[model samples]
Target: MNAQELRDKTPDQLRDELANLKKEAFNLRFQQATGQLENPARLRSVRRDAARVKTILNEQAAKAAE
Candidate 1:
């Protein structure tokens, strides 16, 4: 997803997306280890997406705390 798409998500939606991304990352890793993955780049993409969601979540939490 792009930055604008991420920005459009609410904190709750971001958290849900983060969870799904993490699950996908784990599955990708498993597939890679077993030589079943079709695209290694997908793992990297998922990781980055997860990070983006996490960063947004943290930013929201910090803003709320302030």
Candidate 2:
């Protein structure tokens, strides 16, 4: 998912996405550790996506606090 799409989602949806991405990241790490990872690039993308979700969440929280 892109940042634009992420910006459109509610906090709840973003939280869910972040959780899923984190789980995927963990699994990817496990796969890599065992040399079973087919797409190492996926790990990078998932990590970045999770960060993007976090950024959006922080923005929302900042707005709410105002």
**Candidate No. with top lDDT:** 2
For each candidate in turn, the TM-score is 0.91, 0.97
Name the TM-score of candidate 2.
0.97
Off by over 4 Å in 2: none
| Model 2 local distance difference test score | 0.96
lDDT score for candidate 1 against the true structure: 0.90
Model 2 alpha-carbon miss at residue 33, Å = 0.4
For candidate 1, the per-residue lDDT at 60 reads: 78
Give the per-residue lDDT digits (tens) of candidate 2, residues 26-66: 99999999999999999999999999999999999999999
Scored by TM-score, the top model is 2
Clashes of 2: 0
Q: Report the Cα RMSD per candidate.
A: 0.9, 0.5
